[model samples]
Target: MKGIRAKLSTLLLTLLLLVPTMANAHTVSTTGPSPDLRSALGRLLGEHAILAVVAMQKGIDGAPDFRKAANALNQNTDDLTVAIASVYGKDGAAAFKTIWSSHIGYFVDYVKATAAKDEAGTKKAIADLEAYRMEQAKFFADANPYFDESIIASELKHHIDHLLSAFNNYANKNYTAAYKDAQTAYTHMFATGDALAAGIAKQFPSQYSDASSTNPASDLRSALEQKLGEHALLAVFAMQKGIDGKADFADIAASLNRNTDDITAAVASMYGKEAGEAFKTIWSSHIGYFVDYVKAMAAKDEAAAAKAVHQLEQYRMEQAKFFAGAIPSLSEQTLAEGLKMHIGHLLDAFNAYVAKDYAKAYADVRTAYSHMFPTGAALAAGIAAQFPEQFHTANTSSVPSVQKVWFQVKSNLLTIDGSKTTMDTMPFVNQGTTYIPLRYLAEGIGAKVVWDASDDSVWIIAGENKAEFWLGADFMEMNGQRIEIGDPIIMKDNRTQVPVRFIAALFGWDVRYNTTDWSITLTKAMAMEASSNHH
Candidate 1:
């Protein structure tokens, strides 16, 4: 329970850090880009590119991880929807999702057609995507009058071209061209985010302020976060390319090396030349350790992998000590713990990638990327403290409070515990009961689901209670006694589906069926009691 809470806290804190603080209208204006809005859009748009590449790659290969990749993409869409909602409200977000998701579906269709070698199907999918681009462009242009429809549509067409080129190149086995296109597509999304965010900021001047003029420190911190985080992302990508012996392996690795130099130079600017050199050596050594681990895994050398892990542990200690020595405010213990987490997330992401667990891999990628910002923030804060003259102004920005909302398919939106999430597979009514994805629902409620393939059974362990059920079975064993459900366990679209009401009842949650909105809300009994008490 402690571990779960800690994990949730970390997730929440990372999210809070990414949100830009609302600024007053009277604040001094800047002519250039808005740093706050850029930071927010960069994260989302960057992630969209990353996930899209992963999905396309996995889809073409017919890999099991494709489902996970798609799910991660859906989650990214949810985040984008929330970001849109923050500015334009719920209806606007819903409208955006409708168009955005259609494009994703079209991409999926394209991939499927490619896999089947159906040229006509592929052409149809491409045509659908072209139509989707126009719709999306119009959606944005209509929502925000700051941008011209013709210009937005032209840009959208370019974005579509980049993605389609990447996919087509991959389908043709043109690895070098494919990767180059992917990189271009990835980079282009940042520009998209920046432009869109600028439009929003201009439209809502009171709600959005440029961080450069008001809070240079936060702006600087965001810049550091972007560079350092991108280093981790590119390093991982380079390693994967290396492992696959891709034609562009050298180019990608060179990119990663350049990122290292960039970070080192950034450090040198803040610290001294000697300290920067020291930091460069230490930082690059960890990347070397990761390479060693990857090589060991490729060779199926467990002992070598273990040795690499041990070396990384030592590297963490040395890195922590270096930070502690440089910054008086950062304690060794705290730094060490944070470094361990950083190392763990990176290793986990790498391992998941190797194991073909695309979902976990991308999730870890997000976690690892997010973890770096705090490292940057801590180091920046220490520098600011040490050289108060250089950073005279204090950061007065406050974390934005988030409201959790709930979602329904093609209907009005709702909320759960003030949080909103999207599922690829929507809940549906089967006979008299509603069915939802078992793993998603269970995990959302902080439960673990273990599948026994030999027996086609699922064991859901939530807290102290255990529930067991076999696929196509009408009976579920909960804590010992067997209870009958109206619908049997079933599988749809490779996802396990179970009756929502039955699972909620067994899990001690109150289930409310919203007929008007066509949504189902599940609240834990304890949470409901707490809510009532507060009221």
Candidate 2:
């Protein structure tokens, strides 16, 4: 048992370390509208939030990779320098860089203190972070001379608080709460990014006046990018559910988000917005259909599955019409290339899920989704055609982060110690007294079932015998086992959250999740096997 855990941990460490190497040696990313002061600062703050997460992850993982973490911190400081330079020119940017770098050092101290469990050191570290916030806020305002420091501090304070909470949650093993806070931190960062971009465009108009926020930088790209993000989330969950026959999906989602944003945006601009929307609607519909198709396929419903494919074909033609109508300059040939890319993404996700190759599925999902680049060029190109100088004159390619990072998977109700230990690691739901679907119960007896999408029926089989799963105003089957009372499967976030008891019993193990208190317990079957093997 220890050996397996060790193996998994080592693999995890290797994975986390690789992320920074691909991330340009932990340095800050500060491209796009560099002449705009506000945008520059926003990007800096955004990077800071990301760094904090990276730092926390490293701390928890207890990695020896200091250069990577430091590089990430340095990158953030570099962004700060960029913003200051834009606002206060060379002198100010240089001054702020030194002060900003100090916080990174202090953060390193904090991580050390945490590892040593030093109470006083922890307090001191926290104090340093607070001081960094106030001083940096003031410095930025002073650098700009015209902008108000108080407002900057106030706007950023909430975001900083969110980041701190996430770090704390991770420290305490409250991953569920940590992840919940993480969403807020990341989402709010985008707002800061947008504000900074707008501030830069507002401050250094000559260099960045042509940016636009309303339209993405281009018309050819919007729909594809949107679908890509959705695809990212889906691929992760599907793989996690074991519906895809591959490895973990979380890592894949992060990589995709980091790598593809630019490409998605560039491609969309070539097509236009209305056309993008048209593509998005059809593309999104297909994903839903694909999910339905999986259910039908699992059930061996040949007719239903065929019907799904037919509907998808119809959607493609209709989608083609929408693009043809919106794109005035690009003929069918150019559109065809872009269309193929979109189709490739969908096919990749669907086919991977169908094959149960979840790792490959996620790889495709990440590739497809994170490919959108929300840049000033794409935004400007689209706006240039419509509003001309009114929009083209303003630099506003401010792609704000999506706030609200609630747990999509692996939330907890309580911890082993009776505290809100963490809402991470795995998904959980509240136990309830409800009727059990026969197929769900049958799963415990060495059977698999498929849910029918069109009729919402569950088909089950176990060694030639057959049963079905019915929920909500449905009749009971005579053959399947009874699900114990007080452990009903609750539906949350589209996935059904079954009581741990059912899964453990069906799978020959023990499990528990206290959604009411936020805790989880699982005793795998292998543990007993290992014990027996040991004895």
Candidate 3:
């Protein structure tokens, strides 16, 4: 057992030093819009990465403040489950929590085993973690075919290895190695999160229809949403750490302040320098109020805490008025009510944290974080309404029935009608014409596709419109009239390929080809009205 343990430790440490750093970097454009799905997932997953390290460190140290770390981890779990529920429903989220929490338990077991110097127990814990890696890999792989099982399994192994190596190093008093591994582990999770989120978004595009939020036109809104939401999360975390007198309180507080700087810069980019500075002043004041409340609570000064709470209420009104003044469309009363909710949630979270009601405190943290999204949206909408020309092209129509198709070059994967579809033959560009599989295109456009092998012909029927084309035929019979299409129908990989433009013209749908991105967008004629109005 000792030999095996030594070998495993040596292997992990070698891998730790050898593993290439992952670049999980993302640039948030203050002038563009991004998909809300990415923003929300990034925040949740990033928080998970940070909280997991904090929890593990505290637990391994056997610190009295471990409870706070544990509570933060629980809060992150709750947030993750909520995010999963948003896409996969409540039952799916419950299943996710079970599988996810099991791995955390395995880590705890490993920590215990190490502390006791029990080699056999440590081996058992590692074996359990290996089992968990496969289980989680299968879960995500089965959830979306795009998430290849082998790839997921490999990545999960990396995650487990990094965590184990970090803990092992820490146990051996290799402080430098432990910290390095922990940082790598934390960074790796961001990539894992991006992959998972992209899979989920591709699997159910309808749920993430606001993909245009990341586009350059809506960058301001997306940036603000991320910055503001992170502020709420980090502020709550910092306040809790401060109340508990945790060692990382100063670092967490600085992070919260950095988020404020990011948000101020976002505002400045949109509203102007003066407005940004003013907004920063107002924002920083509220944070100070929260700090005052935390300090007062720490000292058990009831009167001081009450005074701080009153000041926060006044600050909320000031913030509401400021936002309302900036955006004429925004009602001051509505803003005040929203600000009140924000203040209430933050205060409640802090109060709950101080009282050791961790569950309630974390619940409030989720509430506060989620609340910022709508606030950002409202602010963005108001800005867009005021300056329509700047945001007109970025605004996507809120057409509930409209279907979107994103065709990528050399890829069989396509998002058809807001759902991912895999085709046997990929869409390709031959010369100047783009050819797509006839069957997939027809079905994607809500048309009935039928192939008659006897005549080597394909039939496309859509509500009183009928078109028939034969393989290798240059002309198609549309409603009994022969129309000469310059491009011949060809077979690619046993699938009949047709010119997208010809088929779109036959159905009276709009076809747009983007050469830069190699994407083709098809929108039904009926949906065009809503899209035009959106601009």
Candidate 4:
């Protein structure tokens, strides 16, 4: 175990450290009016917020990594300047750089004042920021018609407030509030990115060639980027909090759980409920494994650390497989490689922090954060390709939503939304309950049933809801709550049979039983139609 841990740690450190730093490492779309520009701006802007927050915290603590964090933030600023140049030209970039760079200095002034316990200096710094906000808002407003100076100024103020609150809370040892504010500050930039990009795209529709910045596909990309990038950043912070034995470790963990829930919801919205449940389990396990590694390191338990690494190795392949199945364009091998890099980034960063290499630790944090942009791009493209109508700019066609399912007791025939099929095992009456083949009924209602061979359990997912029960178990678990099922699942004709009414009710499907013929009918509006209607 010691040898394995050493080797794994060494590999991560080597890969992360040897990678060259690029100034503008976002997806560049040189061709006119591309949504890719929106993604790029979002990445750079969001990166700026996270880096700024981290640097401010480091500044307050006088941490060894303070200079490195500041430098990284500057580099992000440079990237943003270059991104502006691409759209508006060098003169405009220079104007943006001057206005943007001054605000950062004001933030630094506030940090220094707080560190010195100079109340007046802090007030003066705030006044300077208040003034800078107007100048910055005017710069954007003058450049684009869509930007209202007052609204932009207000947004900038919120950004400043969140960052200052985060730093002040950190300086006062209010770590939980500090981290929460930090996360908000980080997320706030993405909105700014969207607004800025949308305005720019509108300002120069010819350059973007009529591509809408807020198109469905582009929105999907930005969402995935935000969630995945935020995951990496939050994971790094949680690991830091854990290692330091900070009181806010639980808060950070809760934040990570919330992020996971969001990612799960995104997947469920696009793929289905089963995929979402599976993704949640898989994604959450990697986080748990990282926690295990952190705990093992604190305890100086090399074997435990190695075991955690082993679990993470398994997680990479499992996660890759899940993505490969969900997105046909993503190959298992390729996804595993990408996940390996992600895991490596977290592990390497954690190890660097433990060794007091704070600079490298923060650098790895930036690297890990930036790496998710292309990943989000890949996923967005794949999803759009898989469901063309969902991403179509013009809504001229639609999917035939499944809405009804029919089954009869002791009959192998099944009807799903007017389409008939034969089930391998027919539904039967046991005592007072009607039992049906679990998989057949689940699929018939547009829900999915997944079997876990390792535990002899079955999972049912309907829309955003998921339930799991082991074969012959008299209980089922849904969203972490256990419920009693009086009738246990059993095998009939070599098929898993579950109570019909219970399954239907769990999925919010209306159930009808004809006493004359003993036919069972399940009805529900499928997600596709619901989404179309809402849209």
Which has the greatest TM-score?
Answer: 4
Q: For each candidate, give its TM-score against the true structure.
A: 0.60, 0.42, 0.55, 0.66
lDDT of 1: 0.64
User: Which portions of model 2 miss their true places by more than 4 Å?
Assistant: 1-45, 64-66, 197-371, 374-535
Q: Candidate 4 local accuracy as lDDT?
A: 0.72
How do the residues 123-158 of candidate 3 rate in per-residue lDDT, one tens digit apiece? Answer: 999999989988988887677654555556656776
Ranking by TM-score: 4, 1, 3, 2
Whole-model lDDT values for every prediction: 0.64, 0.44, 0.65, 0.72
lDDT of 4 by residue, 81-102 (tens): 9999998799999999999999
Candidate numbers sorted by lDDT from highest down: 4, 3, 1, 2
The alpha-carbon deviation from the true structure for residue 216 of candidate 3, after best TM-score superposition, in angstroms, is 5.3
Model 2: per-residue Cα lDDT over 132-249, one tens digit each: 8788788766654323454456445555567667777767866565654654464355445544444345455577544322122221122222323334443334433234322323
Position 414, candidate 4: lDDT: 88
Model 1 per-residue lDDT tens digits across residues 253-278 = 66567667766665665566688799
